[model samples]
Target: MLEATIPVKHKVGLHARPASLFVQTAAKFSSAIKVKNLSANGNFVDAKSIIMVLTLGVMKDHEIVIQTEGADADAALAALKSLIESNFGES
Candidate 1:
């Protein structure tokens, strides 16, 4: 498994459009991906599920840990880390 912690920089965090983009990105990979809201001391949730991700209540400046496993784990981790680091394109 591969994992990384990143802080969300989007003004709205992972809500609405950002959340959708995140889920969409995760869906592109076949690897299993999970995200935990470290800022909220939250549990891991399905990265590919909009509902599960939304439930994370990830606000701006919140730190999240992304974990991925399976054949594309490295790629999946990189993609997700890039997404968040890019502020979900909200910048």
Candidate 2:
């Protein structure tokens, strides 16, 4: 398994559209992905599920730990890291 801690920089964080985008990105990977909101001290949840991701209550500047396992773990981590680092493509 591969894991990385990433900070959410989007204005609204992981909610609504951002959470949807995050779930969408995770769904593209064949690997199993999980996310935990470090700042919130939350437990890990399915990254591919919009509802679970939303439950993390990830607000702006909150740190999250993403774990990926399986054939595409590396790619999955990189993709998710990129998404958060890029602020979910928001300006």
TM-score of 2: 0.96
Which 10 residues in a row give candidate 1 its minimum summed lDDT? 82-91
Scanning candidate 2 in windows of ten residues, the lowest lDDT window is 82-91
Off by over 4 Å in 2: none
- Model 2 score (lDDT): 0.92
**TM-scores of the models, in the order given:** 0.96, 0.96
lDDT by residue for model 1 over 1-91, one digit each (tens)?
8889999989999999999999999999999999999989779999999999999999999999999999999999998889888877756
Off by over 4 Å in 1: none
lDDT score at residue 33, model 1, on the 0-100 scale: 96
